[model samples]
Target: MFCFLIDIITYMHSNTFHIIIGPTIVKSIYSGELTYDSDQFFRTGNTNSYYYQAIDIIVNITGNYTVKSNSTIDTFGYLYIYSFNKTKLSINQVTKNDDKSGSLQFTLISALQSGVRYIVIVTTYSPDVRGPFSITVSGPATVGFHVNTAATKPSSSVTTTTRTTTTTTRTTTTTTRTTTTTTRTTTTTSKASTTSTTST
Candidate 1:
């Protein structure tokens, strides 16, 4: 009997928005600063210039994954999974949330293809609402599969079973899972308020 095992690791970053190319799971709490003239901007309306900071990660497995951003002040979190083309990049999945009076959290539950680069952005609800914050990415670390060697002959004696175990670590941040099916695509967005928006 021969056994084959495959290990996958996802690298994620925070704060300075630096890219670390390697193989490992990332779960870190960062204390950073944000301002009106920070970095990238995700414009939804014609009000203020919404500034944002982004982190790029390469995913090698397909499964349900969650990303959380917690802050002392009101904030917003945005996630974008896309691919690059000859001229520009095309977005595959986009999720944004401004709920939970003090933080924002969103989950991407879709079939993520292997060898694809995904970008995750964490920002405030509006411009100039900046302070210390922490961001985390958690989900299944490995995806398992089994193959039977005696496929040519039909026999009831041969049995193959595969099991997958997923473990999640809990923190102060609240998590919400959003499911996305293959047949339909949905996008959820909420309008930012000047004050705090109570969660219902």
Candidate 2:
């Protein structure tokens, strides 16, 4: 039995521009800074004019989760998992690095469900590129169960009994028993990979 719970919420960089940088709850390693008027309200559509800044993570324990971002320039990483009274916008993972060498990274591996609440968005794909960024979350704190058992025995057994008596005396006895039962089922399948890296 193993259980590990992590909750981290931090936001401190204020000049009043709609502060809400984090729904904030991360397992480990969170550092922040994204300039050029930080809040853009998370809208991705209509021919690219980038604007995104969001952070909110709450994953109590389910299994297989990783959200990563490292930046110093050209950055873009977005991973979202909602649906806890926030109207449902579940699991959207995005990363950018379209032929610009390096320095923007995003990695995500899903399969999370145990008190679920996730929203991580770090911007600057293009639209006033910023500086200093670091976000990290590693996997497997819990959510694993495995049990297997198999048994079979009884190779040989034989018994015979008969009785007979003479002159108005008679006895009869016969017994035979054999039993076997077997059932088996097994299934396994797993695959999780989401990674984006750029270096310049």
Candidate 3:
């Protein structure tokens, strides 16, 4: 005699799973009009300023970014990426570290909406030589569960007596001298991390 069986599972969870896996956003340096220099910063104004790329997001996101200096100027910078539709909403704004030779990298610890476009960049003030900046964001990762049936053995053959035993041991106390305990836990997990960019 032969037996065949199948197991199907359905799960419900937050669509935002990027918090797992790696950061949804992998950081990278801007290619042009940006570098780690302390002298050429003021070319635009006394407080060296410049905007890098625009990030288009489907939802309102909250993450941190950093602006750093690579020279020994011991200087700091600020990040203010405002939204086009909401002038008062600063998509990203914060101060980075004190490393004279490291670029700024900030993190945003908040939630995002359904549809919003954002700007991500940095502007700093120091002696006058600058070029190079990078931004990174955290998001959810995607994962899936599957059932495999690829084998040479007959698929309908029962390997042993199969049992889905959910054993919850509970302790029972006897009239005057004994105790018992029970354990209960159920887990079904999923994924995160996805990124896309557009001009804003």
Question: Which candidate has the highest lDDT of all?
Answer: 2
How should the candidates be ordered by TM-score, best one leading?
Answer: 1, 3, 2
lDDT, residue 114, model 2: 81
Q: Which model scores highest in TM-score?
A: 1
As for candidate 1, its clashing pairs are none
* Regions of model 2 farther than 4 Å from truth: 1-48, 51-68, 72-117, 125-136, 139-200
Give Cα distance to truth, residue 20, candidate 1, Å: 36
- Give all TM-scores, in the order shown: 0.45, 0.22, 0.30
For model 1, how does the per-residue alpha-carbon lDDT over 101-187 read when each residue is reduced to its tens digit? 333533333344566656655566666566655555543343221211212111111112233333333223234557786777799
Q: Each candidate: RMSD to true structure?
A: 36.3, 41.3, 33.2
Summarize candidate 2's per-residue lDDT along 13-87 as a digit string, tens digits: 212122122122334555666655555432344433454456665666776666666666666665655521112
Please report, as a residue range, the 10-residue window in candidate 1 with the lowest summed lDDT: 150-159
lDDT of 3 by residue, 1-200 (tens): 11223333334321221112223442322222233321222323344343222223223334342222232323343323334212222335432233434443333333333333333333334334344433333333111111121211111111112223232323333234346888999897877778988998
Where does candidate 1 stray beyond 4 Å?
A: 1-32, 40-42, 83-91, 100-111, 142-200
